[model samples]
Target: MESLQKSLLVTGGAGFIGANFVHYWLNTYPNDKVTVLDALTYAGNKENLASLEGSSNFKFVHGNICDQDLVEQLLQSGEINTIVHFAAESHVDRSITGPDEFIETNIIGTYSLLKAAKKVWLDIPKEQGRQALEHRFHHVSTDEVYGTLELRDPAFTEDTAYAPNSPYSASKAASDHLVRAYHHTYGLEVTTSNCSNNYGPYHFPEKLIPLIVTNILHDKPLPIYGDGKQVRDWLYVEDHARGIDLVLNKGRVGENYNIGGHNEWHNIDIVKLICQLMDQAFENDKTLIEKYPLAILARQAKSEELITYVTDRAGHDRRYAIDAEKSFTELGYRPQESFETGIRKTIEWYLDNDSWWRSLIK
Candidate 1:
């Protein structure tokens, strides 16, 4: 790889936000090449990036970030000039069931990447090494790091103290610390973006939005944790990709940016909204009425009927809202879609792309 071309190695590019960022950056920066390294875990599906299969500037590598040898090789031998690390075990419910993978991948893997970067960067040729040092290592993270907030409190700002409540969040916080430590101790050029809940097309099925959509499609009971009052700031996936681009291309190194839309909705509200949208979409589609008569039988089926409260998620955070004012005022960053518009687009995408989701089940 040629460093002059600004190649980026995006870890976990097959996952949800990672895939979005990969597509976003490749299209946004046509001159740059992006190499995606994903372990292809249950959550990491290659189909997400199938759209970029033949592009000259895009390539995918299946691997874990913890592989030191592979990490070192990619750093030393690629035209790789940037790294946007998005690989991690992200689901809090899964983390509660099994937390070991989160520790291994999020924390240790981040350390491995940071170590590789340090080894590659320590020996500068001195004549003109500063330009190469400008290469950015952008860390894609979650706003869950700041834990929950009271309803009346301010949203999480960059200065908000870390208060993780779950295994998943703890692992992410550990990784964030490692990233910050690497920047401070070894002078690695790094920027971190902690974001809110991301919902859009291509999302894996286990998460809230996708899970509900899939369950509704199957006419199964839609499960809601607790009373479904957990408040979360929702940001569109592509908007997140745009924020990542701004942070990677022009952000100040060693800075942390919160990326999220100001839109906040409780979990139940979101699920209800999904049901309403699905009802509207289904009513409009004559084929849906013919394909599934239950949908027509319950023409007035309220979205709320699907809601069933299960046991509250263990270690569930009460609320997470990001104050993206830094990303907004500083980087000239702004999301093009509001939550309403973004959700509608997402619902439409899922309806149009049936086979894409079906293929992922196996």
Candidate 2:
């Protein structure tokens, strides 16, 4: 990828995928600049971006994306020409527990950003508009937009219709439509990527992989919904970040790309794998490595000891797979990390970064 010189606005840069993408781009291009606009919600973690604190090229604006005045001020300013928005309430469980926040942030916030950009990009004064950029609004989205698939169903591609099952996904679908509308009616240069499940460092503890890891570390029972047969295409955080970079820099305008690792696993099986990996991480300890590492688990363990089945989430998607061939072919994208490599690294990150997530539980 050729390095481009530009300043970009990132909403929700404090969250997992957004933060990872922010770090990825800044490190890849030294001359480029990034100004982050985050609302600092419960899921947003400012501590994750603490390393970029005083950099000349990085600026953190502590505010909500839904605030039209703030969003308009920044867009109409002279610095930014590109935007990668990832600031949505992403947790399905939390969306179930309380959905009002999701509607407020995901739908309303996205609408405000679009309207602000349309106004400034098209109607601003020449003095301000001369600073206008070949702007692109890259919306980072999820595979849940296509809803679920049957066991033998083909993977979801860019053309898949929206059939979101959860409130979180439903709200994302609405936002996705808004992005598309901005492109068609207002001619906003935009792209959308609906990706599979992502797991990696800096992830909030409320998520599945981190939740399991934290609970396992605390010797708590790892909870699984239903029989745990729900399947998902697991993509690494870094790989997902790279995909976003490709879409923003190289993908065609008004296009939607589906991103995934092509690695699929049953939920129950993944849990067992984590348990076995935890045992391996605990290997040097004198307590239990001898018995578990007797075999490096190719699949997860059946340790009835740690598995606990809970009530299934209402409207849970049975399976989600992504046919990411377009991104792979057109954008020259391939997952840099395999599931095995990614999962091990994810486990290591949790082990190393205890202090960050420990605060969340408090």
Give one digit per residue, the lDDT tens place, for model 2 in 1-362: 13557778999998898899889989987778898999888988898899999999888999999899998888767457888999999999899999999999999999998988887776564446474446878898899989999999999988888899999999999999999999999788889999999999898988888887777766567799998999999999999999988898899999999989999999998988888887666754444334223322311333336678999989889999999999999999999999999999998888778778888963
Off by over 4 Å in 2: 1-4, 125-132, 285-304
lDDT of 1 by residue, 1-362 (tens): 12245778999999999998888887877987889999999889899999899999888888889997898788667747788999999999889999999999999999999887776655442444653444678898899999899988899999999989999999999999999998898778889999999999889988888877766776667898888999999999999999987887668889999999998999999999999988887777767656545543224555557678899977788889999999999889999999889989988887778787866643
What is candidate 1's CA lDDT for residue 15?
93
Measured against the true structure, the TM-scores of the candidates, in listed sequence, are 0.94, 0.92
Clash count for candidate 2 is 3
lDDT of 1: 0.85
Model 2 CA lDDT for position 168: 96
Query: Which ranges in model 1 have alpha carbons more than 4 Å from their true place?
Result: 1-5, 124-133, 290-300, 359-362
State in Å the error of residue 176, model 1.
Answer: 0.4
Clashing pairs in 2: 272-300, 272-301, 273-300
Report lDDT per candidate: 0.85, 0.86
